[model samples]
Target: MVEGAWLWLTLFAIGSTTILTRGSFVLGGEGARLPPALQRALRYAPAAALSALIMPDLLLDAGAFDPANPKLVAGIVVALAAVRSRNPWLPFFAGMGVLLVLRKGLGW
Candidate 1:
């Protein structure tokens, strides 16, 4: 485990980096405008980030591709539900319901 001066130095470096990056936009003010292409691309960042975080869990089981994985099945179900339903909550709940039923109720 990290200890002593090295740990404190590491934490300070991390904290400083976070503050500088996050504060850059605010400090730059109205003149600091992103390019139009960049602005458009940023719109997909949230979805990309979400998929980056979730796709692995859904597609991989025990570090191998598993077509029969319950999470994979639930993810497909949720994607369909999101496309069909206008209500956001419906997909969220549907995904959770399918996951729970598969993982717990049906013992997948």
Candidate 2:
């Protein structure tokens, strides 16, 4: 675990880097455009980030994929809910509800 001055220094460095990187566009003033390559790459950032965050939970169970995993079923429910309803919170609630039902009620 991080401790003492090292932790403070690490936190300060992270905060400084985040502010500088994210705020660069605003600080560069209006009408400033990113390079074409970066603009193209930025378009896929959300999908890539989301997959990076969620793919592991959907695919992994005790270090291996398990067909019987409740998370997999809940993820499917969430995916279908996401496609069927455009409302942002619907998929989250649906996924959680399905998970609860499967894990608690059905004992999946």
Candidate 3:
């Protein structure tokens, strides 16, 4: 509603939401400990979010789904690396390397 720039407004909204979300856990006491079933679901949250973020890029082909794609292959490789190792940089480099090889070296 203000006459300020869009970027500042966006940043403010993000920062405010972050504070509120973080504060929920910080303020909660022993009552906040999640139940077993809920904790099981929470365990998969990261994978679910990652899939939501990555699936479109891997599955989309010129705005449509294409089952056979290099990006999909590389993404799977990266996911495997992440699942196997605690080190963060390895998966990143693995994904980046696969993309480079597919796009530059193999021309596919």
Candidate 4:
């Protein structure tokens, strides 16, 4: 429905806002230092973001919580493998292997 100069203007506004907000730190240089507490909190942002993206898929099935889901089991396996093994790839491969085995080999 939106096709004309208005759409171009809206898109340009959005793009400019995004660039300014995302590049604020770089543009401000050392004067824009974050507080110490905020800096420390940012350290967990990646893990929190990843959990936000993955937890729903792992815990839900057909719009309901599923404790017996194979993905949940695989996630548990991944957590355990990560804790026990030093290699990062081991947990990923182990989780995928468990998932494949459960979904394909055992038909869970």
How high is the CA lDDT of each candidate model?
A: 0.90, 0.91, 0.87, 0.93
1-108: candidate 1 lDDT, tens digit per residue:
988999999999999988897787887786887799988998999899998999889888998987788898889989999899999799889999999999999998
TM-score of 2: 0.72
- Candidate achieving higher lDDT, 1 or 4: 4
Give the TM-score of each candidate.
0.63, 0.72, 0.68, 0.67
Order by lDDT, highest first: 4, 2, 1, 3
| Pairs in clash, predicted candidate 3 | none
Clashes in model 4: which pairs? none
lDDT of 3 by residue, 5-82 (tens): 987988899899888867877876547776799879888988999889888999998999996888988989898999
Whole-model alpha-carbon lDDT for candidate 3: 0.87
TM-score between model 1 and native:
0.63
Q: What's model 3's TM-score?
A: 0.68
The true-versus-predicted C-alpha distance at residue 73 of model 2, in Å, is 0.7
Misplaced by over 4 Å in model 2 are 1-18, 29-33
lDDT of 4 by residue, 1-108 (tens): 877999999899999988897888977796767899988998999899999999999999998988889999999999999899999799999999999999999999
For model 2, residues 1-108, the per-residue Cα lDDT tens digits are 999999999999999988897899888897988899998999999899999988888888888976678998999999899899999999999999999998999987
